[model samples]
Target: MTDFLDPVLTFIADNPSLAGLICFLAAMGEALFLIGLFVPTTVVLVGAGTLVGLGKLELMPLLIWTTLGATAGDAVSYWIGWKFKDTIKNIWPLYKYRSMIESGEEFFKRHGGKSVFIGRFVPGVKSVVPGIAGMVGMNFTRFSVVNVTSAVAWSIAHIAPGVIAGSALHAISQISVRLALVLGALLFIVFLSVMLGRWLILIILPLFPNAHAAIARWFSRRPDRISQWIGHNFDPAHPRSTGMLASTIILLVSMPAFFWLIGEVAPNEPMVRADLAILNLFDSLRTPLGDKIMVFMTTLGDGVVVTAVAVAVALYLFAKKAWRRGIGFVIAIAGTAIFVPLLKLMLHRSRPMELYTGADAYSFPSGHATLNAVLFGICAVLIAHERSRWAKAAIFSVTVTYVIAIGFSRIYLGAHWMSDVLAGLLFGTAIVSAFAFVFGPIHNEKIGRLTVAGIVCAVLAGFGGWHVHRSFDAALVTYAPQVHKEILQAADWRQTTWRSLPAQRIGLNGDAEEPLVIQYAGSLSDFAGLVEKDGWVRPPKWSLSTAGGFVEGETPPDSLPILPRSQNGRQPALVLIRNDPKTAKGGRWVLRLWPSRFEIMEGGTLEPLYVGSVVHEDILRPMGEFSGPKTDRDLPDADNNPARLVPGAVVRQRPGGTPVVLARRPEQPGLASQTGN
Candidate 1:
């Protein structure tokens, strides 16, 4: 496949004549039944679009050919339905399509011929909508009008990009094939991620209840003073055993498979960035305000901060009260907020570029994937309970569609890796299922913290609303760094080595060259973090970043760059935290990166800067430290940061200049400090 593209690109580069035909075939093949299913036509569509942007393909001709093919395909599909609607009902492949036909019928019955236009987007109906319209005996004149209007819109939606993408690729060809692919891929991946992310979230959400149950069970089982305290106060009958046992089974059965898929796929190709580009383009075109409306699309669901808020609204409308609903909603969101980053940290995934972009971080178990699963899964569960089948079906459809859309948002936003989202969905669904069984609505709360959960959820929701009311993006900052690379001696053997173990070749370069290579060390953390760094950069959780070879007159290895010590835009900046003893795990630390002003002119170009990186050891005194607050001030103060980190190692590119400070052990009762030193 790699062998196939270069020559074609070269040919197009010279001829410029064949570009339209190539795109035409691409569009036709994409529309052709069964064939289009295998190819993931969208990839080719964008490739062609990029070619157009590069001037290799003419926009009008390319759009015209592709549009014609798409229109023809729809027309053919309509004719087949009109002619053989009954024959298809009993035919092999089409037999199962009866349900689809039925669905299209209902949709049209409900929305009239307009369903033809809307159903084109919906799966199950994409190919069959036109046919169903024919089967239902819509007037030929009306159908023609609808089809032409819809087809033009669909063609533009599907094909305009190949033309422009062609141009963008042309625009940046000199940037290096890897960078160009990575950037273009970033754009496209972001487009598709949020939609596809739903599937992954569905899988994982079902496991949430299992995790919560386990947490309850573990807290009870501990013979420790804290366990006893929690148990005595929080209620002894909280189903701790059930939660633990279920969690153990899930860990054994599903977690391993989830991680393995992540290892094999996420880091290898990572389609998130490329998918996002397509999504962004869709948003720009679909949104009445275009890119300006992205503000609303991304923040659309931000209103439902706590499960309680959504739960309250749902129940209030239904005239009912259900604590279990709140639990599902709250835990689902909390789990994603807490665990996704930890997973990303454990995985330490890198972003799409040699130099990290704004969205790059540890991305496994995407928040969108996790939360969307919970979000829509709850909707599905709610629908699943309705007395009417039509009601259930309606809710299920909306839920599934919603999950897909949110997942797409994440991908489109360039916030998650493909597999990250995939893993998130699977795990999320499993969790939601488990929770639904264990904590589904009960008559009472004798065995759980349902009361606390409700209050906590409500409080959180209100706080989230306040943040929205005040301004969610008030603290948000964005940086798009183009990291350049150097092999540094392809054979340099004595490069950076991990204290953890043995690997002869394959070192981590933060985010390196195209087809960016990181030795698969097989540890869950290295493997996951290797792929999803884009969404995974919290402290205790590390990710690939600071990728650049020092140019002439840049800051020396020993000095930190100039950056504001205090930042107000976003509380969680992508800050680099150095951990030598590696105690910073779990969900204790909050990390944020604050990028410095860019300087196009060398010397004038200040190094990238970050602030407010807190390692667990720095913020909290372990039990051994006599349990007290720090008397010292916070960092970028000289008194504080030097204890656990070297600022220069974090501020910019200093690969071997990687600075790691060993965690200081607390003074033991009978031993002197020099005993360890």
Candidate 2:
């Protein structure tokens, strides 16, 4: 991926004029009527912003070109609408999107002059609003004023996120390239998911009214009692029909899936193996930062947090004197609370890790998962019951994302298996749906949806914050990775026992990575002292001051920080780097050491074993202004240099002819040196 991106970035840097032109065309294409629908202008514009942040492209020129292109595109669209106002509705492609045109017209009428500005940021209607305004003979002066200002705001809104992201990635790469990449991928995925969800909802929702009408027609044509009964209960004209039908469908689907999951988990089927595989995968990917994030997410779904929110919402509903609605809300929460524990008792499944004892150890249906799902699921239904399609889509999207995050946190933290979380979500959805279907639509007109939503959010922020702050430390300790230790006699380790250790670093996907080129039998401090004597220096730790070095672009190669790499989810304990000025662009040789599980027992004292790798990195200045390090694949010949510098250091060869460096602190005086291939 870096190989592919490097050349493109280089070309952009070499020809700034051409890059600006491309940005202009992309912005224009994305704003043009109908053509804008196919052009991925937002993504292209964001990419441009990223290049700016990377110092490959100047920001002001690109922003100016993009703004002009957008303004021109809107003007052209308005001209077309005005010229063909009488026949526009019957035009070939325009006729096909009659519904969108009509929707845009209605939006324009409702918001008046403001729609011209507001619609530029809205997804479905952004491309058509300008045309609609012209067709309706809106004041051209007003349109121009709104158009120019909105185009500027829209461009900034879309591009600023990318700029921030690029700047963040650049800083993080200095600490760990792998971490930067992981975080980048996660952010991109989240952005894509949100856009795709919104688009899907917008496209599919318009078809629902037609579908309901068709289904109603079909039922009318039929004479069967079952068809008549379903038609009457699900009639589109009825106030509560849509809610009842949707809830019933969800209940019917979720109940069976929940039972099937139970069956699969009980029999220890293929899903069980998959659960373990996923657990191991997450275990490998665990980092200190990731652990902290997952812990915070999991805490949001804790029993105390969810219960507090549920109780707050219930009280608010009762205060508004909405008796039936309050009762249904209570039933959904109470049912999930009861069902989760009952299932756990019946199945008695164990968590991936023994983080808890007694009743808390059982993990068939994750209480955290079930409680949060129930709380948010019902909240979405209640809030969206009387809202427009757009409001409903936004509400459900947020609710689903939150619930999924909580469930994933449980799995990532090793508190529950994947199947356990899945079962819990399915069961929780079933409970919420069943209650919605039985209770009909909630009516609390006196309490606005926004008011209810605001109260819930406020309580969650205030109460949940306190709970997490109190419990975060204990949660971290409980979820920390388990370590195992082994001891071997110093003589045995020197002879043959060393072969039992891992030969290569393991990646997140369980793939073999860099080979372990050196093994030292000494304390970390001793190893550091030996290497420091040879002119090796520890890289400066990451901080605001150090981060500024990347921007200065003149920091010596040796002063620049080295990116840390992980082996089996563990970061290096000791790192040292030495400048290599012989390379054309200047280079550096980095040495990193990770402590092993094994210890060498030398008489009364125990010396730890360390395994490490060495590599030479060449400086890369793609744009000549911002520089980064690029690692060379072939191992440098300096592999044995560190051990050679140590006093009384011994070297031996492994079976594959790779060299292993061995050393001991002079203070420990018990080892017999014996070496063989």
Candidate 3:
């Protein structure tokens, strides 16, 4: 595909002015007599749409070129028919396929100008219908009028879907995975609706006669007000107009109300708390296996994956002659792409801080959650309509489960709050429901070629999964510097080094335990002052129940709780504490800092005492267990509590370290003076 498209794409990319001509020629070929039957322009038009999205071609020019080309193609066929008249059927291919020409003539006679309009949407019939009109000596003015209108609609129907698909792909790739999921879901919903709508139209068409008779018989039996009301309101003859009016009313009223509600409550503290609680609960339950599963499920909701599905579905619908549904699918997706970003900009809500990699966008109305509800929900609706009872029920169940899982994945990954997901579900569902009302209640036949869909989806997911992994990995690597800066700023401290306490001298009682000691080059007052900076507030066990002190910017706090007075005081001691609910990691620290001493507990702050008051010999130890021996007096067990130090490279060891001592009284005045100096 690339080999075939590269030259064309390059020509257009280099000489953008010729894009119109190329599009015109391509669409003309797709619509021209005889040539239209063989040339598959759907792929070409879709490719051009993608190029337009990539900014290689201008959108308006492309649309115009395609429309004009299609109109011209039909005009040429009409002229051929006019000139040849009744003898045109004697031409080789025409004579060979005289039945098709005869049928077109009959169809034209039956539907009149509307056949010309509807024929533009069907593949083989489109080229033949125009010629049949001319052969029948249809009014030239009327033929031109129908020809131009259908051609324009036809052009948009083909080209716009491609453009929309390409544009959606581009937009999602530029943002985070979470956002991509949201957009993907909306696209999925639109595609499903279009597919379903096509099938529904078919099903409804055949049933219309039966329905009318049944209704008449039932009405005779009733002869009542209810029957009259039903007939008056739901009369199928004008249901499309009724549907449009009702859909319009619902969309106008409900969409604004939904947005308004989101706007009103998004900034509320309670909402924030709810988000935190749900996220924390999920995060606590997360395991490596679950994470892997969530990652794959989330990948399915990616923009690229979803876009591929939409394009594939659109092509299938077009192939099946489901024009209205195909066009609606494209419109629905395009609208979703436009709306999501606008909402995010308006709300500007921040993301939770517990994410593996920092997010760069606002959080309210999570894109992933919205996508899950809209896209997967639509898939369920579509599948439920045509499949057998058990299959439909099973497919519907899985789709719902998948949607829930995707939403949960976002929260578990700390990409969004629960409220954000909730709002997303609401927004996405409303959009889908509104669109369904306008162009749907899709009752499409069961679409075959599941193998094709599966292959496309698998390829998309593989690529999207790789893209997401690369993006996330890169984000995580660059996150540390920002984290360090944020942490320092929050604690109200600049970078400083300290002389390490000598491990042997600080009452280790001959114990061989060596704990990682952080070397800070500052006074006790300076450390306390940094802690008092409000952003590093003490955890609830030591203070208020409501968590606070830090806010999410671009990184999460590494603070944990530890008791200063006792081994089990419940107060977070000697650690940098971020008490904010948004940034909390739901764990305690193993290390602690004090005025003249540092402590390393056995297992986090809650564990038994491991090593305490090890005034380092001006070198911060690099490693220690959370729980172990209290004193250095015990013999080192080879397999058990081995002592290690923080790598000297990290702390930047001095060439010849300064001799620092920790003693209440000195044996000699000279030694004491030297230590002080």
Candidate 4:
């Protein structure tokens, strides 16, 4: 994965001009009427923004090209609409999509000229609004003005999120590359899951009538007792027949999966091995930022939040006189609540980490996962009961995303094993399906489906927010990474134990790269002071402002930010760089120090030990401009010599013959200092 991504990023960095061209094409395709419907413009523009944040692409040119392309596409669409006018309704492909045009016309009539601007952000409406405006004889001047302004806003809207995400990933990579990769994977999985749900619904929705007809026919051919019962309840003529059939299908699938999970989890079988592997992966990837995010996500599935939503939904249903639905909702929620605890007790399984005591410590089926699935699943069914196919698809997609996020958060936070969450989801799904099968297809109800949805969302946001705010700090402490300290005498570390530490720097993919040429046992402040006298200075941290240097022409070697490098999934604690006069265009000697697990007990203080690698970096110019700094793999022999930099530092040689510098701070009377290593 590292090998693949590194080359792709390098290619983008080498060809800055190609970035603008790709953005322009993506924006143009996304703005085109029919083509826009199929184009994945959001993903493309967002990817371009990520490159910008990663210092591979310049933001300004891409933004300009994207704006231009969007405006041009809209203008072309408007011209076609103006030229054809009402005749467009009879124009081959346009005639087949008349319904879309009608929808766009209605939106334009309702919002008038503002529709051109507003529709740019609305998915379906955005594709046809410009054409609708032109067909209705809107002035060209007004259309162009609105078109340009909205295009700019749309470009920013699409790109800003990716920029923020890329910046965050880059920062996290500076802490731990593995953690950053895990976070990126999570985001991608969530996105793919939601998209696949919507796509599946679109593909299957049109075939429902045929499937129903076939099933009805088959049941009529067989006069058995079971077939008779199914045919009677799931008759096509019945109002709730579709809901019942869907629930029955879900039951057929989920029940078996739920039982299978129980068998796998109870015996600590092959699935348990996978569970432990996933847990260990997450354990190694734990970061403070990731912990906070997972905590907030898990809090959304808290009993308080789920119960509040359940109560609100029940009240809405009953108040609207939908007695069957109200009863069914209560039954489903109650079933999940009762079964989760009972199953946990029956299995008596321990959690990956003990976040709570007593019954909470037992983890067989995750309560949070089960309860949230039941809550969201029931809500989706009720709200989508009488909606159009598109509406149903949207609801299902959102529900699936929420459920998956909450379930994954449990595994990521070590609150539950993967099997536990899987069991919870399957069991909760079964319960919801049973409820739907029993009480679905209400008739003559006075309920407003949209109102019910709004109420549920409001209660969740209100209660979930309050709960997270109150418990976040305590949750952080509970989820903090556990670090163990290993102490050694200063003499032992200098003499023999130094050999025990890693001799080479490990890359993000666990491949050995640079040699660990320096070991310092002292306060970082003292080490910094010593290095500063030798002409080494700290480079500015990477940020939006500093990133501008990449696109700027002829950035000085010393002024260029040193891109962070990770060793064994850990970033350096301290970084310093100094100019290399040997190169005419300019080069730099970069030093990165990472705190080792070993601590030296010297002069009654546990002094931190740091392992470091010094490598030379040369300026990279792409398209006749300074792009960024690239590390030179070949090391300069003189650069690794530490005697001239740190006085009294001992020079030792590893078996491989590479020199290692060991330095320590001078001892002070009656003073003891400790630092994390």
Candidate 5:
């Protein structure tokens, strides 16, 4: 819940590799004897499983890494026991947990090598069984067979409970409260399985000695069969051979399925709505600083930047004669570039309406996201082989952060939707994975080339940054003049009140009605002066009472002022208001304005609204009006007391203080006699 976790969760959601790495590390620590004693890895591994079931992680990688980690740890324990023999019993920690170690030894003696398989199910025994097996001179081949099989089963058993819990929670969240009962039932089953398995083994099984012996014999007879099966199917060269095979199989299966899912949903209306909701959320968080940061981050994924960096790195590799790596890099970048746009064209999904500043391309499978994954992800993969463990971790972390930041920038800047970014990441990762697998052994030892490449890339990156800034600035202006034109036309009475007064429920009788909406045709500063001169006062709080008072109504009004803006959550509405200048002198009106138009609301009627085209504000400028659709009520924050605005000047409040002032019209010369008030 800390601010720190937001980026961590976001990174986990965006990158599958990191999630797998975390699972592997947690499992390894959990299975290692000495470390397992100190590390409480259950919660960490279960949390990883929960992430998987919640759709934040891919299940295949999670299973592969966890199984591999657990298996490797067991192998190490077996080696330590074989080397140390009974001498390990004299170790300080072994002396402390003598009873548990003796129990493991007794169990191994009774069950022979089969104890390795059965012990994995028992918590305390699981930590000691592999060592006991090795200490008793069990064959390394036999120990490895049971170690791997049990590790797989153990990883699945422990992680599955969390997976089930997460899946049930996710399903219930999507469907209804009825499904919550199903979720509860699943959790109960997990609890029962954990407790019941132990009870049956440690208590009930002992009561029936014959049956227990029969089961032990059954496991004993299977070691040869299990070894033969493993020999026939699995290569023993790599420690992760089994997991690698599983990952490959899953990747092959998952890619087509994911592509099919994308094809099915890309054109749907619900998908558009989902994209809009996410875009709106990001839009609502747009502060001046955030906008600049996102814009800068977005440059990392820019087509120009990606191309320049890729080419520079590739050239450096070529100069160093690392042909395979250079070729893989090119293919990765080229493949992403080709496939992302191809998929976009095939889907033909239009970008969300909020993406108003220029990118008019099909929005599915974002080009920026795909390219970032290829560019940054390939760098991580290529460097991983040569770096130390700590260095690899740093490289991977930075890569994930860059990739995620670029993907996020796309969504934040309204260039792509959430799904588009997700799809792009998947596609890009697939490309990188394939490239790495094909050319993994290629090494670049030429430090000179690397240095030259880094310098070239640094310069190109600077140029890319400049290009992105100018491009984005140009894009904002591209739509500005046209948007301003539309606002002016919409604000004019001829197009607004003149044609739609009845629709707006203005006048009842068939009477000659004047076009009340005005095209203000002036700068914001000029409009501010006009409002002040016309006996209007801008109030700090925008409320129904103040708005209703403008039209002689009550707090819970019959009608409400319509402010058009994107509301993120329950933030306070920024309000400006003034008393009615004509027809109802005592009545107050809500003055709502955006970059396009300004409106005066008297009892929610279009009471002489104005629109202007002459003023050209920056697209990123924070207009007081809501940025998106109109809300039902533009309410004030309950916690924030109103601050009084000084007449004829902008209100300035000390850091945290309260001052209240009501709106009042300043006297004009002979105004009382002129207006007959």
Candidate 6:
């Protein structure tokens, strides 16, 4: 593929809401700052980021939204610290993770707000850093300075890779069918990993809630063992270094390396979701700018994008004197960027398009999703330092919106399968969360606060966007007599809209005086069949009459896709309301009048049977008598222009009954249910 962004940019233009959401979610994955880059939301976030290249949506709007969200998320975390301070460790998840909190506290005391900056990367400290900063009562100016600076730099840092990838997707989309399968296999692997993660959470997480904690406990049990192991297996300083260099090395080196390995073995699924039908739909929209946008997005995606972002973030942190934090951001960014591509080349999996056409390659770890995920998650952790409630809420909301927006952009852009984005998000979140745990606050208070926060977040869902598709035309006829299933089994559902009789009659003996009016007002497509062959019409004396017409008026003509005109008798059709007369077979007629009507039994409903066809079919030959008004005074100009009548004109049949009138059926419910006619 020449570029990754080709599809991503197009998707952003078409699905702005989705773009906003992915960015928001990625930010929420963590608010700890650059350290948050460890979260897996890169796929989701970068996908949304790619939208910027499309040039349709302005970056300012999204930037404001995401920055605020990150700010808000971290702000709350900080408030929780200010409110309960050192006591928050008693909460459910936190209580179980007391050591992490203690680790954050001790780290904070020596490093001050710098720990908050550095804590953005340390898994345990990422979440607790803000809370710890708040507990220690750091100066508001210093905290905000660090918070906003980190938040802005972090967002760009995380989203850069995603935008790069989107730009490249264009060239990938141009390849032959052979490569498509390979891409598809890669997407499949990404999907598999996501499902595995989900299953792990659903099945294994609850069962082993303390896996990380247990490991910590295990290590605690044998301090000497941990030290010896650290010396043997990793940097000797990890267990004893003042910077926790030994633990850091083990975390940075071991687990991430394993994840990279997992990514290598994964397969791909190409074309992922951009189908020919969808491409055709857009092509028909006739906008040349469409392809242009895709091309721009895909080309921007490259490894250098990640590297540059990391370097920038490191520089910023160092400038701010948050040396440790600068180090963490550098480590996390460098690690993810290096590992993802290595795994891709190692696995050599094709994109979904490679396997099948238009698929992506080496997608086990979605880059876009991971980028935003890690950045946002880290930001959330850091935002916890903000003390203002409104401020925190606003930023938190915005961060989540961006994360979710970017996630959607990936799918809409057709750059990643649904699973790749989700798995990437989850994986990113896990990593950032690990950092948050190690460097976050130690809450040892009651569980009430955590419960309240959960409830509050859920309440926000109610106010979010709510939408659904609406389609009328209630029941579609899949089988009609006009194009009977005999020849084309698939030609059953015919769409029609006619205003005439539904049935017709032909008798040798009966006088034309009455015309044996069986029904009128709908259309004639079903006349010779249901009434003729189906059992609705009797054999001896009476028969039916019918014809056809058109429909009109709507909010907008193009609002609804036009139902195609009939060719070879297969077209869109409709049923007009009409009437029946002269004791027809429907529900055993009572002492009838000139026109007819019946109550037929369907399920438990004794519905009034006016003029309607059993099936939809094209109305042709507009020759037969028209279905009209019931009263003589309302008689339409039937003699002169009976084929097409005006609205509200009276239509009378010969003698007394109007041209269209009902012959009421007998009242017996049992007879209504049994009428074979």
TM-score of each: 0.40, 0.63, 0.35, 0.58, 0.41, 0.32
Cα lDDT tens digits, model 1, 521-550, are: 112233224323323332221111111111
Alpha-carbon local distance difference test for all models: 0.45, 0.75, 0.52, 0.78, 0.54, 0.41
Looking at model 5, which ten-residue stretch has the lowest summed lDDT?
A: 612-621
Give the per-residue lDDT digits (tens) of candidate 5, residues 555-596.
Answer: 221123333222111111222444333322123344433222
The positional error of residue 206 in candidate 4, measured at the CA in angstroms, is 3.8
Please identify model 6 stretches exceeding 4 Å from their true place: 1-18, 25-29, 32-41, 53-57, 171-677
Best by TM-score: 2
- What is the per-residue lDDT of model 3 for residues 1-677, given as tens digits with 9 covering 90 to 100? 12222344555666655667877887788666555655556656776877787566788878888889888888888888888988877886556456557767887888887898998886446768888877778788988998899888988888787778767756754643334333444445444544443333322333344455466456546668887655544454544433433344546765676666585554434445445444533443344444554566565666666676667666776777667766776776667766666777777777765332323277777777775566555544444443443464455455555666677666656667667776776677676666656454444533543543464456556665676676654433322111111112201211121233333212111222333233332333344454354444443332111112122222122321232322111112344443224312222122333222232221122111122222111111224212211122222221111111111112222234322222111121232112122
Better of 3 and 6 by lDDT: 3
* Alpha-carbon deviation at 614 in model 4, angstroms: 25
**Cα distance off (Å), candidate 4, residue 482:** 3.6
The best-first sequence of candidates by lDDT reads: 4, 2, 5, 3, 1, 6
Q: Rank the candidates by TM-score, best first.
A: 2, 4, 5, 1, 3, 6
RMSD of each: 20.9, 9.3, 24.6, 9.9, 20.4, 23.3
> Per-residue error at 498 for model 4, in Å?
20
Over 4 Å off in model 3, which ranges?
Answer: 1-264, 281-291, 353-360, 388-390, 435-677
Worst 10 residues of 3 by lDDT: 640-649
Put down candidate 4 lDDT per residue, 439-488, tens digits, no spaces: 66565676787887898788877888898899888877786664535898
Per-residue error for 662 in candidate 5, Å, reads 31
The alpha-carbon lDDT assigned to residue 263 of candidate 4 equals 84
lDDT of 1 at 256: 67
